[model samples]
Target: MADEIKIQEIVEFLLKHGDGYDADEAREAAKQSIEEGQPVVETMCLQMLAEHVLARIHDPSWIISRANEPDCEDSELLKRLLDSGASAADLALFARMSQREYLSNLGCILDGAGLYDTPSLPHEEFRIFAVNDEDQPTAMIDELHESLGFSGLETEMELSRQAERDSDNAGS
Candidate 1:
């Protein structure tokens, strides 16, 4: 019963994506889905395509997309905070709030608003994640950190040097 539904969904997705519904591929996916006991809706067609079709797509965009997706479990709360006009500090504070009701309700509202951009984090706290399953590729949260002006000591020194040079030029 479910296998049929899985086949239908897979076929529909493939068709929508212009795959033209090949029997061989559909059969294989269906077989794998049944063997894995995964719902038809859970078939990993997109993963296969990422591995095969758009293999050239860079790690950063892929990681950023995953980080931005509201449906993802790991960053779902952070995503909600961004949507709610909450800064990174707000998110961290919310995470500490004792009341679950307030947090959950606000999360739903933020999720419904469709805002999925990342929130600001400190420069020293900037995080990097391996966007994909493999650990070799990494994407950093530089923009959010830089936008917050959380520069490191080295960066501050460089800026100081540039400022001194500009002052000398102005005096001359």
Candidate 2:
């Protein structure tokens, strides 16, 4: 309910600013939104801002264009996939990349979904962390990498795995 109101306020602000406002104004507005407990709204505003400002860059044609120019490894790889006719995996990854701004605009869904304040577990409950799906850690990591381009996921996975290992060691 509160989130919905925040979103409405953001929409109103955007409508007022329109697309003609200066970048600084947009940035300041976004900062204010986040500071006011509306991080999700702020993220949505930033995503819209990117689309408005960067629409001309890396045009949608990149999906069909070949790479002939020097660029970052990721961009070059993306181009190669496009030129070679993107595989299902590649296409999924590409879609994820494209929708990243929007998903991030919704705030950190993964973090928000985690059981941050769950009650204590029973004594018999051994400390074995499992992901939502039945996938092993590596598979989950890969899916997350494709779904969200956060470099920190791998680091977080490592830490989680280490913690599990430490717990098992302590139990033994």
**Candidate of highest lDDT:** 2
Q: lDDT of each structure?
A: 0.52, 0.53
List the pairs of residues colliding in candidate 2: none
Q: Can you tell me which runs of candidate 1 are displaced by over 4 Å?
A: 18-21, 38-172
Clashes of 1: 0
For model 2, residues 40-72, the per-residue Cα lDDT tens digits are: 454556668756644543354543343444543
| TM per prediction | 0.23, 0.30
lDDT of 1 by residue, 1-172 (tens): 8867767766666556534657677667667766776655433443454345333332234434544876655455445656777655444444344234433443343223322343544432232443345433356435643564536546756898998998899999
RMSD of each: 18.8, 14.2
Q: Give the TM-score of candidate 1.
A: 0.23
**lDDT, residue 25, model 1:** 78
